[model samples]
Target chain A: MTGPTRPAEAVITGAGLAVAGYAGIADLLGPVPADRDGDPLAGLSRRLGRHKDRATRLALLAGGRALADAGRPADDTPVDTGPEAFDRPGGRTGVVASSNYGNLDTVCGTVDAIDAHTYTGASPMLLPSTASNVVASWIAITYGMRGANLTLCNGATSGLDAVHWACHLVRAGRVDSVLVAGVEPGNDAVTGLAGAPAFDGAAAIVVESARVAAGRGAPVRARVGRYARRADLRDAVAAVAPGPVDLWCEPEDGAAEPPVPARHRLEVGAQLGRRSGALGVLQVAAAVAWFGRHPRSRALATCGRGGEASADAAAALVLAAPEDRS
Target chain B: MPGGIAGRGALASTGRTAEDMFAALCAGRSGVDTPRAFDLTRYRTRHAFEIDDRPPGGGDVPMRATGWLLDAIGAALADAELAPDLGDVPVLIGTTLRELRSAELAWRQHTDFDTDRLHFGHALRERFGATTTYTVTNACAASLYVLGLGLDLIESGAAETVVVAGVDTISESTFGLLDRCYPAPPEALRPFDRHRQGMLQGEGAAAVVLRGTGDARHGLLRAVAVNCDAYHPSAPDVAGIAAAIREGQSRAGAKPSDVDLVFLHGTGTELNDQAEALAMAEVFGDTPPLATAIKCMTGHTAGASGLHSLIAGTDCIRTGAVPAITTLQRPMDEAAGLRLVRDTVSGADIDLVQVHSFGFGGLNAVALLERGR
Candidate 1:
């Protein structure tokens, strides 16, 4: 068997978050009430948000916020300088999103229409939204990201896997940076399938190579450290955390006990709702916030599909605080 | 670059094995027929490339797509002389609609199936002993996208062996959408033809095993490049396709002149064909590489189409025979100067092959494969 290799280090430059009853990532660290909020897509233009579903809209809001936070253009404003116009950062920016139930509402609705009115009754406009990658596609289209675009519909670990693939893209030299978003909506259809109330928001992070972040003068919040996926949770934890950690963002429905001990433990799902696909990104965002308060402290975020069988893969990643606090 | 392809498998209306499928293609056999899986009485045209025979397992499966996927994986493992259980090896799946058809069946017929099956990881873990699995749904280009990820996993030394598969059954909802979008269903799918009509849906699964430190029985994966058009949702972008082709070739350390054959993503749609032709012209200039479209016989397999082309391209390299697009009577005006394969060419000198997959949402992926030494 081939052992896992330590990938090149990437830095998290920006983060965007939207959760019910919470204002920002800082709020996630402490306790918050369970209250509903207004429409997340209230300010988006009708032209851009014409036929989008709830998950897509939430992803757009969070993705646009992250891009803006990174000091990059958030919307698809045409740059008409010359042939080298696309040579800007947007040209090399890619998007990777994770959403297990992103398009369930659209799919169920379309299927219901087919059952009632046959083939002719299905709306052509809503058909494209049924694809699971619609969220990532919309984010790329809105931001004009022409790099490698991907969407992960993997099970519970999808959010962390999306982040892993984003880092993979940067390390492989495929793209300069990647916009990673994890979104899931608690619509009736999704709730029915999940048999539980889902989180109705998105979390996004901008992960770029350290060299690119330095070149572009972007502030590095945290450095992406070792990442590993193993059949067992203990192996994953051991692989990622060879050294001690300051904070551990434990998976909401993960193992009953912590695999690796940390100074402090934070249950993201307890503070926020059961975010499903958005859980991993939210965990990383909380870690970034913690690093901001305590410099040079390391954090480990772990996630997995909980089970006794070894087939239930677990993933873990280390996040180190930036060296220069200034 | 990714590791070599140790084994490959396929399940389509054309055939179950790659050899059988390629033989049917060379003999000019078509798999398109009237739909038998679902009712199509109210539709204007009722035709799809439906598979009649059940997979290796019984037909009484909760999710037909899962059954096909398991069968394909089994076949791939057997071909590679590996065990049925994948153990800790990672499995990467690509599908446009994962168990959505099963959910539709439940909604329509009140069939009882576990909702957790919607996410394929549960079934994959239970049946194949896969510890890590990634499922990607990037429209029709989903399979190639996952294949690219599988390559990265092996190249990065994250795993020694990886299983990559793509499967999509007929989604009644998607079928209905296509029925309303197209003017009328043509008799057959004639991709890249002058009088080609829109494409018909097809259902199937394809899989390949990549091993970093083992004998590559099939061929070597040179490179895979993926990009989003970021343009219109349904329209194919020429720049995106050209960029993917150029990036794939550049990653493989090959020039435009080095490519011997190209498997076009000819979906028999007006916009798709026009855009693909323009992209080829932009990349290869006046005289492009010898090209062929497998959708003429297999129909458009949607998400599984990319792997279908990749497997067929591997077979072409092994046999030195390129199948003909029998449905192509005349090339389109834009592709007139292109060398579209007409008849099956035997003993042809082919070393490097390129495959193209473009899907809705303007997702584009290209892969290059070299002949196994």
Candidate 2:
């Protein structure tokens, strides 16, 4: 078998985050106060937010911010309004979201309702939320994005997998740009299942092809570098990183430390609390923020249920500052 | 640009193996029966297409869907002449409800349920040594979406072989939702029928092995196209479905006339069937290709329904036999010009086939398959 070739590169143009104690990507670089209480859905209209679950609300907030930060008009804008609306056509932008326990509360509630009152008693408004893809669908519907929409509920690596697929979509020319979000709500339902509090927030990144980014004059925060998924963390690190990186965002529950050397190592879960689905995207967001502070540097983000006997393959991704890319 | 379909497998109410399911479908067998998985005394619709063989209790497996998925994967690997351990080959499984049923059961019975089992990665790794696995929850269009992603992986040289599968068991909550939505439960799932009431939920799993360089004994995946309507959450959009079909044909370098058969996403639901039929008319003009809906016999398998169609389409390409919608009493008005197969057609020159799978969230996916050389 031949080795997989490096995929066509895409650049991260904008990043948005709404984790607890942090409002955006820039806030990740400093200490998060314990008592910060800003509303993630501050700007969302009640009409649009009606019947939306917590995960969907967080995704919408983060997705809208990312698009705005990318210098793109709101996706809800009328397509025939003007030429500026054509710059970020709804038909060309896609959404890829990851959330493992995003809809557990809705599912549990619906099941309870059905159990108590039968099918006739179930709420019609909650019917759509039963499907796991509700988060991604809501983002697309809110933003009027008609491109390929996907939701990954994959295990621990889902967040990074969303990023990988988002970049793949851009590189494959399927979509001009993609909004990738990783969200998980720390509700009682999810807390009970997780045996601990979960991350009650979301993180989003705007990924587009280099040419499209250049054409749109969107600032390149970081270029998507090498990515590899292998059975062993060492193999994945070897495939993605050949030299030392400036920073490494390690997985919180990963059993073994990554073998690759790095100048600094950061753990996302250490600062944000227990995160299952949002860890990977948060890592990428942190890398982007770190790159802003230190130009011409590279960062590696790795995630998976490593060391567990039944855990699947580990994933590693390398991100480079825009100026560092040749 | 096409990935070779090295092998395929399926487990449904109609049959176990892919070949068995195809034979049953050709024989006009219906798997719909009284619901056994859950209590449906209050539901107007009590029938569901459920697998009879139950997996034995014991082990760390979370739900019956996992058992079905593992069995289908094993069957596909065996058919493909590959090692039991997939090693580095990535596995992508699509579904609407992963293990939500298990959660429901636990919540109702107050039994201890491990939340870790909600995802199938651990089980897949432990059973098949599959290091890479992705569980995509794209609703009903999931399996076909993963099939498209598998093609991209192979075409991009990411992997020489990739396994794509779809599995979903009857979630009581989903069944209840459908029950409330339907005005009345029809006797059976009648797709494209003038009096089609609605669709019944089914539990099943299907898998297909895709190879970049290998003998494609089943068929070649010519192209796949996916798009979101972004119009409505639950309603199907004519424009989105039409766009997917046209885009798929364009990517496959084929015209509407070149398609020999079309596997409709006929869910027997009023809006879904009407919207799909209109989309077909928009894409194929006055004369559409020969079309059939397997849901009539298998009772919409939810997420696995798309792959169920693909498996049947592959069999048609291999055996030159096309199954008919035996339950269709009267074809709907929307599909007036299109040819809806009513009786089994044998020895048909079916080379190029198109499969459509649409889901809630207005997710539409279309895949084109060509006869293997």
Candidate 3:
């Protein structure tokens, strides 16, 4: 594993989060009505339609608040296809968004459609949006970042992975700035399957290279110290015999041990969310919640999801971003 | 000198090694066979080069195709001359399915289950004691993407050595879904041909051992970059392709003027051919470097395509030549402005070749591999 180290260029200038245990997480859940349209065309008015899903609303609210806390524009004018957008303080900004269970409302609606006797009525765009990358796609479209954008889905590691990759992009000079958004919305589909173990919420951080943050006179919120992931879930499960019997036995491989000791010290939610995607989002939200409290504190966050046998993990170290008043 | 093939393993219909697959290609033999993994009764395309089952308990290969990947990884470890104690080695796997078929089969036999229980990443890390690992699942580009990640790990001093592999096997869910999407049954996938209809999905696994500057005896990773189109969901923008090409060439310290051969993505889909051909023509002009497609031999191996092409490029370097684009029967109009490698032989020693992977959600990755000095 690489040592806990921060890249030279990347600095977490601003961080904002909304989680169940954290204050403002519930209010920001917004208003997501059960009966909503599946395929609404993108428009000035339709943009508000996304508010129906608490995830998007919380994402915007938290993201808006983060930008506000950093003294940036409350609403970053969309930087669509122009050198002008890249020239702005956050214009050339790139994004790495994560949602373990991205757009759960879309997933539920799609599943409901598929399960419904009337398959023809199902929305075509629903399936596409239900994909893991949709949140990143939505963010890029919303923010107008034409640079490197990725939505990683590896159980709970989604958020930390996003931040980890963001650090790399900044260090490698891929993007001037990055918006790492870890979002999970309140949806019955997710809550129904695995019960809402962790409160649904969203967290976003504006990251930039130290030089870029200083150049723009932005306040540095935190610094990413190190990041790593151990995907040793295959052996985590007990091995089972082949044929039609013993289907539920975990693999018995000795190497299935987790890289980090089990998280018995932490206070976990009531339910073990079934969806790897959801657990990832919750972990990210939790990390964001933790980071919010300890602005300058060096913190380590790990999010993981295990199957009947397999387990996936993503980990990151968050530290206070150094201040430089030029 | 370019490091010789230090470690290689492959699972295909012929049940062969890296050497065997190469020999088969040289002799003009293909492993394409009848599809037996699922009920293809309702479809017109009932053919696939399938691997027979091997028991899982070190007996017969129970999961014949999937086991091939595990065996290939083992073979790579053996080839690298590394002991079974690979605790320090960082492992990265690229696959779209995540053993989806295995999980699906398990689910069908018994309901209410988490299908990811059979994830390949978990399997490899557990058996090999891999330290750091991640699964890259971006459709067909998964393999190459993982390979690129492995290179990054090595280049950044993340690991002394990185094992990168890509694998996918024929699954009923994928097959049935693709069948429903495009009903051109059992038709051989043909790329850059005007008459090309659609794509045929196939399964296989391949792995490579990438080492940093410390191990000259192993191999050198030239340069690999994963880029996104930032545009549409499925189509590759001309600008995105140009950017990826430029990025690969720049990272490899080669200019467009220095590239020797260009290995096309060639998914055999009509739209893919048009987009890739346009991109190639724009960058390399009329005399684009000797270009060929390998997907014809392997079908659309999805996660395995990127690594498979990388392996093919290595084979090209080792053999002092480029492989032919297996099934391009006719020249399509879209490829008219570009140089297409066809029915020809060349002694042109390609110092640097670019492997292209344009996949789901506009993932356009171009990996540059050179004859390591």
Candidate 4:
């Protein structure tokens, strides 16, 4: 039988997050003036086409900041149709974005348009944006990331799953670096539909392979260890060392909550107000920020449906400070 | 390269099983008909490729998309000889549209919607006893993306077996958007035809069982690759699509000439057809292999379209028969030197098959499958 992987490490070279306390992430991360709508788009609205939806705006805002934080070029936009126009050097940097209730607000709007007027009255632009992948493509174009891009719309676990995939690809050497992000728009429709009052926010991490970080002289913030997946967290939790650990658990509605003796456990639902996809990432950002000081702590983040055997989706990730492994 | 497609099944508008769908494709039969499952009185387009609502285990009840899913999955597991428990296998399903019917019904009935109970993953996990489940929603190319993820999982030694599937439905929202986007279609959807008008959106579901090729249980899943055009939100980038196809071929250890047939994305829209032609030209040059765009018969099944194409390609290698385009009357200038099959051909001596799926927002995926031993 195989033991758990020997702690392959990647560092958080840069990070960006969108939170409710700040009306707009761009508003907080910017010297650039906010546009007429009072959200700092970094002058990207005009370039990305006006009438950018809330999800689109939030995605690009967080993505740009992540790129900028990583010291990579961030402001390029899709200019032409030809392939030559998009050719760039950071071609190996990929993007894996996650959204649980993906742009459903836009779909609701399209349905409302049909209800208000005729089907033809629906905005042609609105239909395309409804799919979650649209935001990932724009992020790739805006940052000139030509590597593999995938959008994960797998309900609550979307964020951590995207990060997990990013780690896998980086560890596998398929890509040098990846822009891993999770986004959820704060809207009444999603909350009403999901029955969880998920707030609006996005969080992104710039996870580069240890080689890439070392080559770039980037500081290592944390290391992500091997993940275990199961229908129930019972088996998964048993595998991890019992201790005070930072936790982000979105248990199924009636399941008894798992215990976290750690004082630093993030009240993810309380902090983000039940944001689905962005919840796990919110915990990650908070944990990474906390571990920066401790430098010897570990954080356990879990995102999935329920504790029941029928839950079908459950993922547990181990993230810690660089020195913890030693 | 570690992923091997062990078993496959499909439920398309054209036919139910993969064999039946391939037969219908060769026979030039279409399942496209008027939409009666839902109220589309508000939309201009009245026709769709709606499944008959009867699904395995559904027991005469209207299953909608869920029915189609269980039906395809039932066949796939049966083909793979997997029992009911599925034994800790991961079920990764790709779907573009979720059934808004329940959410709409909840709104009408004034009951709180428990998304937990209603999600397809919950249903599959309950019925099939699967432990790991994922619902992929990356737009049109979601199935191949799910399959590609399955490949990664097996290659990374995460799972020994995986059930990858894709499903979507003919619903009010789909036709409404298609009607507004491209108002008119000249009868049957004629993909890759010079006189092609637009696409006819269809619905159904399909599934393929995958295991690591080290077991050599089925056809080798040579490569499954995904790349972004990052060019446009709706239209695909020719250069990006071309690059993804070439990259997929290289990873599969196959040359352009080695590929016996190609199941093109062939969405039938003017720009898509043109862009695909340009993309194919960039990849295969003058002597591209036999090309088939069966969307003319099956209609585009949205996210499930990739699995439909993958299953169809698998049949081509098995039977050594190239299914016909069925709706192509004229070839474009870009398809000048390529052999576009319009009628079914038997004994083609096929080996490798390359399937392409390009979705909204430039998410392009390519899968290379070989004949199973």
Candidate 5:
């Protein structure tokens, strides 16, 4: 009843990010920006355009940078399918991005659409891009990726879970590589006024099976050795049942080990603008930065919020390759 | 699927009793009538599949649209034989608009909007009084998505049991929104028909009890996966639907042949039917299993369709008989090779059924439900 110890093929090869304090991994390790009293989305206020919302902008920018970082094109192109598709390391690339407030722009538009009829206002373009999934499709269409594209919306865990699932996809041989990103723009009038804390950022990583990344000569950043979901950790206690405990340790060799990094303290009062979906990006940014500094360190992203008070979730181990593996 | 509705109840236009509703559906009776739920008299089209009622607790009742939800939740608890005091069990309610009723009230009274009280997420926690609760407002697919979330919680040992609910009642805001965008013909809902105009806005509430695996008689909730097409918000990526079907089947530890039937999210809309048909064909090819939708019978109940279909499909497997599509005289040519269950097939062993629900955010959710072992 045992499958191959695949070693979690979903490893990060490259990452690209754009956010408030620092652009890319620089901001992750650098000093975080101070939260202003009245201003939210302080880092991204100047970048908003009439057409694209904050989420889409982060997606496009980060996606473009990630692809560029991986040496892929930014624009869509007509390509012949078959073995040649696999020959190109990025051909089988899929996109998985998560965001808390998908298209706040569209939500506002729907409100305007209703208001337009009420007050005889202007007719807004009720574009499908406004929906959360549009970012995924936009990536697929733009990149000509005929592989899986998914958007996970588990609030702060969206980015983390998307990366987790993206890793699974690679392990399952659904795709050779995946572009997993989490983006959130500052909330508009509705989300802003309704107490959605302003968060602005996008983080993406190029993930591939270790074998595939090795085959393509891509640099491997980390190998996610193990991932586990824990619940209700606020009490500093986990309701460890025999069965879940077994599943958690199923793939482990001998020791029943706790998977988080050493010498790490959980920080509170962390504020990101309304892009809660970018929480994964935050986690990745922090982990990658930690790796960049400490080199051999592994990190874990843990959180639980939004009504399910007792629901505790911690994506345990984020491990990087040994320094010489590069 | 995983946990059958051990106890369940529903409130629809045809009445709350299973017998009354099933009998009416069998007789090809349509519960759709004049657009009373919403004031659609201003627009050219003024028709809907509406339900007008409310739950037991008293409050400044908004339009009687979401009333069926209360009854449905209560009935589900009763069916599951669950105690009203669920204690620590989680509650996940899927809705397109939990505040539409309040919004209607506010608009009617010319009052300022209160987002906190009217938000679906907050409202669900208040209504259910659960220790843990969250709202999945992913448009039409909200119900199924919530169900999937509940399944995740159970699988991950987050909760011993979870009550998942989906509810959307007819409202002036929805009607107005649909009227402006989607144009439905003033008649019966016809899924897969070439002449299909749009979707009929129906209202209902459905709740299911999901229990963890080790529990006694915890039915097999075979497979459930929610994939955001990240396509257009309104339209599902046709290719993504195929990917979902493939992924769902793989997760269920089954093959294409294992699916005995398909309970489609057929709203009788042109875009949806075509997209679904193409997706099904792409996944299962021409020799797919028998496909049908209950929308023609129950109408597009928004968030309620997935759970409703899950209930109906489970019943079909439990009873060894697939219910016929009432009043489906003609099937689409593109839907060839797939048998349309027009006449009720008696004593067929339907071991597995796939239920699909595509929501407004281009969120595609497919759930594979196998008969309880």
Candidate 6:
């Protein structure tokens, strides 16, 4: 009880994983479907019908898993998705979803319909969902988390930045918990459309304040402390998590790591794909889930993209094993 | 972790720079005109505000929003006197349709398929060498939230300085949706008026440079808050919108008495105006803040509307003249607590400005701006 409150150390009480044609973290490594190319949204038949676009489905699946992993209900008691309709553990829960290409399939498709025929040709209903917030809105509505709904699209930094944002809000005492989702639903057709083979899949995590997690005695999957500018493993990592630290980040961001005497390695980005804003969170969630079985080791998830194209864009999320509950 | 609005630039149908745009609005120059973004011959009404300026050899490329974004960013950098090389500076851009117009061309034509959606970020990063570029598209409120995110970046030490931009180009689908959503005789756009009919479709792009207190030049931002209704996708709940407004005020530590002006989202739609009125009553109590809906001047810029409103708020704080809502000849009957600005009200000692932005599907954001003190 007598330790400095790590500005960035929030407990990752729950984690969720979902990719194209998959349901939740259970199916993450269960099996690769023989008909992988077949309809990726067959499981969502009862939940959604016509407008179940790729981005929306990915958000829902990942969000559902994250909620369940946190020991919350998959769906809130059917209530209005309004401010008065929802209740939160700490009165506020935010969802920040990151993406570079936001609902592009519907955007391009609607534009195509308009071009091929006319305004009357394209579905008016599909036009509104083109906004990137649709993903965050769908996630909040389905889960009934009503703190905030924000969507950030800044290449791969989008995912990690969303994490930083959630951390900042919780630290600021604005929200009690945040459900962060990094979803792009990557594919060849989409990557080809974007002119890069850099993205595919979705990942989510439930981040609550260290005080809240400690109060409820929820087993902390990992602790992310105050976000330092340079992920110098020494200062950025909280004192409470002092141990032999291992850095987990994508290959692109490995170039910036300081020569800290710790086990530095790459985890999810390489296998997922490459060059995506969603990698930041995917790798963070991947590392959190990785530590589920292998406790005692500290893992810091970092990712970045900068230079000739975007301004200096980079972020890092520190995760470490919790102190003994006993 | 408070931040300041260092610099700003706007490119709407009315004028380009802040001074020019404000001058046009003060001179009663409305940007509303017939549709030039697309052909609306068969629609009920085809009124919209479309920009006339084009980049050199423009329309030659599939992505037209690129040119507008570049121009706005360039202006913002110059206005803020920031260096062109944005090393370690995060860039946040907001756009509902990054380049849907380009997609329309690629779809109908076999030879011109170049509607690449992800090129906006790459193009800016390569040209400007930014830290990172972000695109936020939460419909009309995207730009405001993007600005809010910029504040988060500075507060979290992600970047000492950040550039926020909002850009949206009108296309056939946008005009079509606007035509159907508020199918009224759109000779002009009117919000908060008793006879208010619909919002005109407008294309606009704007940018602002935000920095910590050390770098803030013109004004300071007390707080920025955004939340979702979890309500219907198309309809907004008055209670939800009011809750967001109160939360933003609480975060800013500002009472209704501290606010000198309020920039209503004022989309000119009936439901939006009424909800905003009810929200004002809930927040300001008996003494409501002076309100102005500027869309009647610039029409509705959609995603870029928030930036436009922020720009107008900055002018109000600096010049001490609140631009009045022009189309409010017959104000809404329920707007008792709202001090509507019907004409140019000047010579007021304005300190704090509260701005509201709400989008479809229950996305709501409110930002509080204070004159540098």
Task: Return whichever of 1 and 2 wins on TM-score.
Answer: 2
Model 6 per-residue lDDT tens digits across residues B127-208: 6765445666676888897787778777767677899888887766566656655646666667788888877777788888
Candidate 2: TM of chain A? Answer: 0.91
CA error at residue A56 for candidate 6, angstroms: 0.5
The lDDT per prediction is 0.81, 0.85, 0.57, 0.72, 0.60, 0.69
Tell me each candidate's TM-score.
Answer: 0.94, 0.95, 0.77, 0.90, 0.72, 0.86
Candidate 5 C-alpha lDDT tens digits along B66-129 = 3556567667776667766554476666766555555545545434555333323333334454
lDDT of 2 by residue, B1-373 (tens): 8899998899999998888899999999989888876666658886889887655552122488988999999999999998879867889998999998888777667567777778788788888988778899999999998898899888887889999999999887888888888889777899999999999888899999999646588989999998888877899888888888988998899999999999999999999999999989888997688999999989888889999999999989888899999889989999888899999999999999999999989898999999988
Q: Could you give candidate 4's per-residue lDDT for residues A1-326 as a string of tens digits? A: 11355424566677677554444333322232333333334434565546566767777777776677778757565454456533454556788887766576766666667766768777887767656576677777777777777777666666777787788767654567888778888776677777565667677788888877888787776788656556666555544544566544434232356644544444453533566667666556655666666778777777664467556566667788867864
- In terms of TM-score, the best-performing candidate is 2
Runs in model 2 deviating more than 4 A are: A1-8, A75-88, A254-258, A269-271, B55-62
| Candidate 1 chain B: 10-residue stretch with minimal lDDT | B53-62
Comparing 5 and 6 on DockQ, the stronger one: 6
User: Candidate 4, what DockQ?
Assistant: 0.45
lDDT of 1 by residue, B232-292 (tens): 7788888788888988898788999999999999988889999999889889997688999
Lowest summed lDDT across 10 adjacent residues in model 2 chain A is found at A78-87
Which residues of candidate 3, in runs, are more than 4 Å off? Answer: A1-7, A14-143, A156-158, A181-204, A228-296, A304-318, A321-326, B1-6, B13-15, B31-34, B41-68, B111-118, B170-174, B183-186, B214-219, B344-347
Please give the lDDT score at residue A86 for candidate 1.
Answer: 35
- For candidate 4, the docking band is acceptable
lDDT of candidate 3 over A171-221, digit per residue (tens): 755567777776766566545433454346566777778887788787665
Estimate the lDDT of model 5: 0.60
**For candidate 3, lDDT tens digit of each residue in B1-373?**
1223356666555445766665555444656666765544444566665555533442111243446677778877787787655654766666655544543343233334342333444565456755455554455666776666666666566566778887777654445445544536547777798777777776778888777554533234567766655455455566666666776676777777777777889977877888888878777876677888866666777777777777777667667666666677787987987667665344767667788976665666788777655
> Chain B, candidate 2: TM?
0.97
lDDT of 5 by residue, A128-150 (tens): 44334556655655556645556
Q: Of 3 and 5, which scores higher on lDDT?
A: 5
Give the clashing pairs for model 4.
Answer: A186-A200
Mind sharing the TM-score for model 4?
0.90
Q: How close is candidate 6 to the true structure, as a TM-score?
A: 0.86
